[model samples]
Target: MNDDVRNIVLGMAAAGLSAALGWLARTCLWNRRLRRKQAFFGLPDNSESVLVVNRDAGSPDLAVHRYDVFALLELSALIKECGANADVITQDAARQGFGERTEFCVGGPGSNRRMAAHMRAMLPGMRVNVDSEPGPDRLAFQIGSERYRLEKGVGEYVVLARLTTGQPGRARPVFLFCGQTAITNQAAARYLYRHHERLARKHGNSTFVLLLKVVNSQAYGPDVTELVADVTRAAQAPLPTTAPARSSHRAP
Candidate 1:
């Protein structure tokens, strides 16, 4: 071959090699990222998980909120991206123990009875008035001396938690999305999906409970969110029920 033809051939070969290397690097990085996400979500590749949807306790027809539905759709997409299957079930239909699968529980006590029961059984110390008619007068959440009330369009709060059992054999994680309203719940779910890496770095696969605040939700939808507090300790601890000295404990 002539020198020009040889140079052209060599240039094309070099370009092809570079493109192949770039593709390989991207594939590796993508795989690595997926692996980390799968681990963080505690769902192995193609393994099954549970997505627990909640119904309003007072609803006559047992309807799930639209925003909650949006949150679930988002969650479902995330699960699919991680190569995991989520068996969707309502809160009333959900059985105890989560049955060896990573379970995602969506709703507060007023919306999901299962979540209410979980709070009663697992998180006794934290006071939550989720069943009440939400307003400034009614206490939405109380942790120690601090109180949070739902202001609807103005501001709202949600509880995002990754609950892990101390049982000997259970390896799966339980994610709790307890929010003041459906919008807040959606925000919390989005936050967890988006920031799972940061959360995994800080708290690992272990238990973590956080209060997330959603400001001006009407304007921004579920996109705007802020981490209010790390209430892991207070949430997991048992309350002093024997003496009704200070805080008013409301039943779920």
Candidate 2:
């Protein structure tokens, strides 16, 4: 081959090689970021985890709420993305040993005692209040001075929290996707799965809590959750003497 032709061919090959390497590097960085976000939620690759679903004990058929089921499915998909498989268990069937494993708890304080107890112990500032009267406005979840209530034909609110228990060397991570209503619960789970990477970047591996407002809740389900507040002080703050008082008015 002529010298000029040989030089041109060699340059083209080098450019192609460089492009391939650049693409590979970008892919690797993206995967690394995803893995780091997954790890922040205690979902490590090739790990076994547990999903504790809540069912109403009063129901004879052991029926679960529709939104709870939705949350379970969405969260399961997120776990799979981390290359982990989770064993599904109802709240009644979840035993003491389940606490040792990485867990994702679905439902509100009224339905899931395991998650409620954890919230009380780990995140004492937040509380779920069910109204004594039976009506559409019967439920609300409170955080400190703020109370998020359900308005008929309007919207609802939910809480998403990540916590770690056990010893430092062998900490067991637990995620809480809970709300006053099932719709809100599903919204909370959806928010976490959708924006977990952003959350991981903001908080790193530290424990945190989020309050999300679900707009047009009756129509859109989880597609319209707006961030109402995000709290990161629960892990370091001292426990309060009493839970926040329930407000009779709706959140403004």
10 residues in a row with least lDDT, candidate 1: 243-252
By lDDT, the best candidate is 1
Clashing pairs counted in every model: 0, 0
lDDT of 2 by residue, 19-84 (tens): 999999999998998778667867667788899898753366778988788988998898888888
Q: Pick the candidate with the highest TM-score.
A: 1
**Residue-by-residue lDDT tens digits, candidate 1, 1-252:** 999999999999999999999999999999988888887788888898989999854578889889998999989999999989989999889885743788889988877887888788767776677546645535377764556777777678889988777552357888889987888889999999899989988987788899888888889999989887898888877765553344432212
Estimated TM-score per prediction? 0.88, 0.85
Residue pairs whose backbone atoms clash in candidate 1: none
User: Looking at model 2, which ten-residue stretch has the lowest summed lDDT?
Assistant: 243-252
C-alpha positional error of residue 204 in candidate 2 after TM-score superposition, expressed in Å: 1.2
Q: What are the candidates' C-alpha RMSDs? A: 4.0, 3.0
Give me the overall lDDT of model 2.
Answer: 0.75
